[model samples]
Target chain A: MTERTATIASRVGLHARPAAIFAEAAADLPVEVTIARLGEPAEDALDAASILALMGLGAAQGDVVVLRAEGDGADAALESLVRILETDHDA
Target chain B: MHTYSGVGVTPGRVVGPVRVMPPAIAAPPAGEQREGTTTAEAAAGNLRSAAAVVKEELRGRAAKATGDGKAVLEATALMAADPMLLKSAVKLIDAGASAQRAIWEAGDGVAAMLLDLGGYMAERSHDVLDVRARIVAQLRGVPAPGIPDADAPFILVADDLAPADTATLDPAKVLALVTAGGGPQSHTAIIARNLGLPAVVAAAGVGELADGDEIFVDGGRGVVTTDPGDAEREAASRWAEQVSRLAGFDGVGRLADGHRIPLLANVGGAKDAVAAAAANAEGVGLLRTEFCFLGHDTEPGHDEQVAAYKGVFDAFPGKKVVVRTLDAGADKPLPFLTDATEPNPALGVRGFRTDGTSPGVLARQLAAIADAAGQSRADVWVMAPMIATADEAASFAALCTAAGLQTPGVMVEVPSAALTARHILDHAEFASLGTNDLTQYTMAADRQLGPLAALNDPWQPGVLALVQATVEGSRAQARHTGGPGRAPKPVGVCGESAADPALAVVLAGLGVTTLSMSARAIPAVSAVLRSVTAETAGSLARLAVSAPSAAEARSRVRARLPVLDELGL
Candidate 1:
């Protein structure tokens, strides 16, 4: 598994447009990815491709979350997901 | 014909088939089992197909939508096909629940989770429920619960509209809006005004109207007539003609006899200033400075403040821009300036009172306004809000002078200020009647509360009496300071009341020299004002102020104004 961590940068947090954008990007990637708040248990991780799960995660702006992916292109997928999470969509 | 009355928020008349927004879907019965030997796997399969259909439908609509509407529709579409929701529903189906019950329970579970997250996340729960309803409706082979899909323009009647629902409304498809609940200041009314759609709110019994029912809605009069006669249809047609003929404001406001009444726009920030200028507003009457300090944790620095104010001032190079200093507290509390835990923030340390706690904030803001004024060609006049006594007005005027800004004024929002306008005007250069707050303080009604909407109305005789007193006091002060020949110190109204055409006429008669409102209201007010002379307006004002109640005052003044009918106001 390839893992990466990024802090939310959208002013309104990882919800609405930002969450939708991130979920769509993750779904289009080759590897299956899961996300969890940094301090949350691994078992509490949610499917990163699901907008519902991303919104339900309630990761506000400045919150740090961990992303884990598994497959041939897992490292590249994690890098892309981290980039999406760190960019401010509101701006 | 059954006639219902409500407060008309926007003006126009339309007769159309009604489309009642479907209510929220009912929760499926608990412990319901799949019938007729339908296995859990088959029920799960049905749920998936239903979800797919709902998703496709939303996706199609999303493709056709643009901007914010497109984003909202796309988000909802994603919710319909969310794997988390499908997984939970399949689990429920495995426990012997029907497809409808399974999806409903799963949706609720997800919604509850989102709600638990709080604030912005909590609002998304509504989107989940809306998606769930669509899926459930698909499964049942029924119409989805929301704004009905209609090919022709229709009147939309609802108990009240949620913000999400109102946001996606297509104005081309909706002729008018009628609601059983909500007041003039409700979200429905505001959205309808922005869209230029005629609307009536707080009309009791409108909820009983069925789809396809023909109704005539006179938005200006707030009357909804079911099974209307030929006369109503003719009236609607007349309204349509008048609406088409209503030209843009020609950059001036005058009575029939050529008495000039300067029309201005109440703007929040630089964007609104630009829009107002595009709409040909003579000037900015109330430049609410709260936009700068609202979201900040601390006072914005002098340069940042100057830049923000300059953007607005630059919009109107030679026009008057009355800048109201930071009105922080009550409905608009700032994190750094206001006490969040006040027992009654509205009556607490708000507006001008904030300077007492944070002394330099107002002074800094004034200096910034002065700095911005110096750089721009706009005639910037400053005012402070919620000043009750003459001493408060005197202190505020002194602050403006010390900051090197001239033409300082005080808002006559508190009843005391209006009653003692003479003394207050003695200290200040001018007075602006903030009718919304003036009405609120006079009637002892919270403007935000729907039940008090009647009392909070600016047309209330008690409020009008105070307005007349303010004008009288201003006149008295002008006479004392500069003899009877000097014009009354430019008393203007910067409030929602100024937007109402009939009320605007009455205010003009009451000696208000200027009327400031939303830019969209300028054309209608300018038209209505030109239809009556100053003497006619004075008589109408007398009729309104003499009435015992707000309803009486409104009806009396409207009855005398035949121009309202001609213009379909």
Candidate 2:
């Protein structure tokens, strides 16, 4: 498994437009990815491709979250997802 | 014909077939076993297909939409196909739940989770429910719950509209809006106003209206007549003709004799100023400065304030722009300026009174206004709100002069200010009547309460009397200082009353020098003002002020002004 942590940068956090964008990106990747707030139990992780799950995570602006990916191109998927989380879509 | 009454938020008339928005989809019966499908796997497969169908339909709509609408639809589409949602539904199906019940309960669980997260996340729960409804409707072989599709123009009737429902509304096909629920400030009324669709809200029993039922909607009077006869149809046609004439207003306010009365707009920020300019407002009458102060925990710096003010000032080059100082407190309390624990905020320290608690804030604002004015060619006039005494006006004017700005004014919102306008004008250069506040203060009624709407009306005889007093005091001041031929200080009205065509005429007749209102109201006001002479307005004003009540005042003045009926006002 490839794992990464990134802080939410969108002013409104991982909801609405930013969540939709990240979910679309995650769904397009070859590797399956799951996300959970940092310090949350591993079992609490949710499918990163689901906008509903991302919104349900309640990740606000400046919150750090952990992303884990598996299978082919896992590392590349984690890197791209981390970049999306760090970028301020609002700006 | 059965007639339903509601509060009218906009003015116009129309008759068309009704298009009732479909009610929300009912939740599926709980604990029902899977039908037709032989196994749990078959039930789960059915759920997946239903979700896919909903996702595809949403994706189709998202492809055609743009901007925020497109973003919302795309997000909803993603929710429809969310794997986690399907997994939960499938889990339920394995536990002996039917496909319909499984998906419904699964959707609720997700929505409840989002709701538990609270704040912005809680708002998204509604979107989940909306998507769930669509999927459920698809599975049930029923029409989706939302705005119904129609081929031609129709009057839309709904219990109330959700913000998402209004997003897909095609304004061209909506002739008018009538809702059984919601008030004048509801989402439906506001959107109706923006789309220029006549709307009546809080109309009881309007939900009973059926599809394709002919209805006559008189938004000006907040009346909905069912199965209207030829007379109502003729009136609707006449109103349509009058509305087209109103569109031709040349952006100038004048009387029949060509006496000019400048029509200005009340704007909140630079964006509103741009729209006001596009609407050809002679200038801004009330540029509310609270936008800079409302959201900040600490006061905005001098440069930030200057930049914000300059944006508005730049929009009306070489034209008058009257800016009201930060009127914080009472209903618009600011943490940095007001004591939230005050027993009576309305009667407590507010508006100009806030300066006493937070010194230098008003001074800094004045300096910023002067700085912005120096950079722009706009004729900037500064004013303070909630001034109850001549001394407050003098002190406020002194601050303006100290900041190197001229043309300091005071808003005549308090009864005392109107009573002592002659003295207040002794120090202030101009006085603008805020009729909404003046009426509230005069009648001792809370303006925000719906029940007090009658007493809070600007047409109340007591309120009109105070307006006359302020105008008379201004004239008296002019005579005292510059003799009989001198003009009174330029007193304008920047209030909701100024937007009413009939009331605008009465205000002009009462010696008000200018009328300022929302940008959308300028055309109708300008058109109506051009239909009456100064002499006629004076008589109408007299009739209004001498009337016993607000209703009587309105009827008396409206009866004398034949142009109102001619224009379907």
Candidate 3:
């Protein structure tokens, strides 16, 4: 398994709509994302993109985040996430 | 002029000039530049210097204002410190726009940026946002909606209060606080009630209130109009006087025939307990211990719980305190109890039976209550909820006895508990009727379920039958234990039910030795009890229990009583 780093780019960052979009993207996939706060350890509680749970991570700008993908379309899954975060869907 | 209604937030009547906050003024346009200034940089410098002056003025005022006005300064100070706004302002200044334009544009940019960064309040507090909006308006020389004090007494009206802005207002000077917007949880509302300032928000056309106009504000009815006629003024004055009388009341529960029923305060935390104790309340009726254990990684240690209990107990030297052990795991959630699934949190495994399963949690909690009680002269009573069978009640009694706790009691909350109060009391020293939960369970309706809330009325015959049955069971137990005060010691009502003034009289009249409720509602309840004699109260309680409908129950009580002179009812 390889881990990649990405920033949240969609305008409605990791809240109600973003949580749904990100959950749908990860459903049934052999991948996991841990939303970490500016200075916190990643934990299993971040298994789902719950708006409140994600907020616990406290991710903000100029911050580093880790995404891990395993099995077959790992590359494709990681690439899709990068694009999702890079574009401001909230705009 | 438009007139909207809201809860009256502040009290009093004043007639004076209205001082609307000054509007933010914009600088000269680029096309109309001064003869000497050919470049946009010159215009930018002029605008920048002017903004500096306004910002400084804002800073100076925030430091000086009192009450809600002082809160505004605190919030304004924070808005003035926002990194995003400050950064944008710098950028606009670099781009050569006028000072006012730069400030306004910077604010707009920051709002747009944060709205895009959504999460669960990840953008920060609404109060912080309000501060930015007001500052920007001031920067542009636009009419800021801030209410002002014009030396003389006058009605103060506005759209809404920023927490900081509403904090500095003088309750006495303020004729009334009439605003266009707010909710039950709004800061203005909380502060108004906390400070005993009668105010009304959600009033329409409050801004249209011209200067030097005569207006009478009814805080209780949430009304503010231009000079109320004589009748209305008399009525409002009577109500105000009544409220003042009730607020000053400090009497204990007494029967017209001279019987005594202890009136106690229901406190949520040690701070509340201290405040109540200072008010000369008989003792704490319900000390919600959840405040000590909530938001923690593990269950609090015996020492920690004991410390908390001791603080509340120490506040009142000789007053009795009833400590209700852990009412959490339902309606209330503990940080570590996350995975405990609940289809409906309110009606589910809460009160006591649910938490009792963990002996370690129970034992430590029991020991803590016992220890706190030992330190004070006041007798500390230990109690639990949701105990239906004799076995459950006995187990709690055994635990409390084992831990040296006095008078381990059972709360008659569920229908099962009320139906078998005799059996439950066999193992306990006392019983307190929690009618709110009993009514919910008896009616088979979720009390918190808004759509079906009507079914949970305490006056419903089914609910009344359950309460009457519980009282009957208590009486039966008294007969078995050698009669009168010798039975299980004491019977009381300690819940939201205990807060109702009319209901307090009824409960005391029904032989309940004590009635406990929020400290704020205690004075009013005491006044109601004092007004009626014990003989009248007993019969009234019977009438209430016999009523078929909630409205009928209330009406019957009111028809028989003269009036609520002190409470202004």
Candidate 4:
């Protein structure tokens, strides 16, 4: 199992356009991916696509979160997700 | 019988079951969320489903109102293309959040982003009214917005009222309204009160009504009689029948002998323009220019405003369009406005009083009207606001007249001006009562206060007295001012009161030649005209002005005829 923490960088956490973009990215990944928050009690922040879960982690503009993937493309998937978050899509 | 309460919009009585459309819930369809395979994918799937649901719901509403569903589709496309929500949804799973929670949080984030983008769009230039468009899209559910004469009379139950929904509600037939959610500040409350639909809100157990259940509602008392007793049903029946029987009320507003007072619609947008047209308003009395200014940073150039203004102008060909020039300040802020931050924006610079800050704003707004008027020979009237003394009205009117917009007028929202209406109207072409703010100012009560809503009544004798003052002022001006050739331009009620048929009669009685409100309010006003003669309406206005309390005044007016009672007076 490999896990990496990433912060919620997008302004709107995930309800609208951002949800579609990220969903497309993880559409065909060959790994089992899960999400977690630093201080949450393990059950609160598990669903990556669930905007509410990510917000429950209390992640604001700069709060970092953890991402984990286990399977063949785990490393590549993690890197891509991280790259998407870190690099400003427009600004 | 089930019961709930909302503010009474239009006063009318009907016997009918209830139609409670569900609140446009913000969940995605289940299928889209099922698309996710991996744990992260699963999270994305949930988020997609939620988005899909909201999209579908909004799309259905949008499709009903416009061609091609332009606004909803845009919002949906933005949602579908959103990467942030999906990312956060997956991250939520990684973070131990339930898939549902992740989708909600992510959507919130994205909404914030879009709002920011909308703001950015406003700052960039004036093209689309992005924020207003979003609001319009959000409120697009009222297609046909008109309720059919239900096979049986019925009340409407909704979570909240949107402007469109209110626009569609049939005042002629509906009995009353019971809404689950709405505050005093909600447009639903305002429109409900305007329409006089006996309504109640915040009542417990009113939300459980099954479709077609019979109930009796006392809107004035906010009481619901579920499975109404025979007495309640009898009273409701008598009321509905009597009100319906008093139709074909003769003549427009009349004076002592007989003079037709023009009743018009106060329109703010193209939608309102269309609604006003449908309502058969005599003309557009108060054409707020701000609707065109919506969603733009810089003032809309002459051509842009002209196009929108022309749409409204064309809505009622040959009728008068009372265009108020760049009245931005406080409550209705413009992106281009400078130095607008004020603790009490209402009391601060706004309306015609914004001159010292920037006369150019007024100039541009007037210029736009002039440009719009250039296209046709329609009778277009222009006006200004916040005129306390005669000088302000004179200056604003002069500017408009200089630009070729006719019938420059002043809105008597300020108490002092309403009292000295003659002095103000002496300098301008006409006057119109801004009763909502006028009442608020008269009582010094915050009209927006939920608890103090009862005191914000426009019919309060004090407000009526102020209205009387404006009438006296305008009447005196009509006699003394206008000079040899020009007849005193007609004064009217252009606030919330004018759209209300009951209040329309009162205004006509009070001596306002015109009554204007949301285009949707025209029919109700016309109905009031059909219900009573101007002499009776004038008599009612006088009583309304002298009565000690709003309730007392309203009761007296209703007592004049059983028809009023039947209309749920």
Q: Pick the candidate with the highest DockQ.
A: 2
Q: Could you give candidate 2's per-residue lDDT for residues B1-569 as a string of tens digits?
A: 99999767678999999999888898888787776545998888878999999999999889978876898799999999899999999998898888888889989999999868754565567788888998889888888888877889999998877656677889988999998876554467547765668888778889899999999999877899999999999999899888778774466889999999999998889999998898889999999999888645468899999999999999999999999999988767676788766898989889999889889999999999999999999999999999999999999999999999999999999999999999999999999999877887899987655445456678899999989999999999999999989989988899778878889999999999999887887888888888899999999999999999988998898888787777776
DockQ score of candidate 4?
0.04
Which pairs clash in model 2?
Answer: none
Write the number of the candidate with greater DockQ, choosing between 3 and 4: 4
Model 3: how far residue B345 lies from native, Å = 0.8
lDDT of 3 by residue, B381-471 (tens): 8888777788989888999999998689888888888788888888888888777677766776654443343465555656666766777
Write candidate 1's Cα lDDT for B1-569 as tens digits.
99999889899899999999887677778988899699888899999999999999898889988877788789888889898999999998898899999999999999999878754566578789989999988888877887787899999998777656665698999999998877776667767876778899888889899999999999998999999899999999988888866748888999999999999999989999998999899999999998787545457889999999999999999999999999999877676778766899989999999999989999999999999999999999999999999999999999999999989999989999999999999999999999888988898987655566677788999989999999999999989989969988878999888989999999999889999998888999999999999999999999999999999999899898888877888
True contacts kept of each: 0.73, 0.97, 0.00, 0.00
Q: Put down candidate 4 lDDT per residue, A3-90, tens digits, no spaces.
A: 7777666664432334435544654566655566666554444655433233233344566767777778789998887766554432
Taking the candidates one at a time, how many backbone clashes does each contain? Answer: 0, 0, 35, 100
Relative to the true structure, how large is the alpha-carbon lDDT of every model? 0.89, 0.87, 0.62, 0.62
Clashes of 1: 0
lDDT score at residue B356, model 1, on the 0-100 scale: 99
Model 4 chain B worst lDDT run, 10 consecutive residues = B124-133
lDDT of 4 by residue, B506-542 (tens): 8777777777776544544565566676667767878
Candidates in descending lDDT order: 1, 2, 3, 4
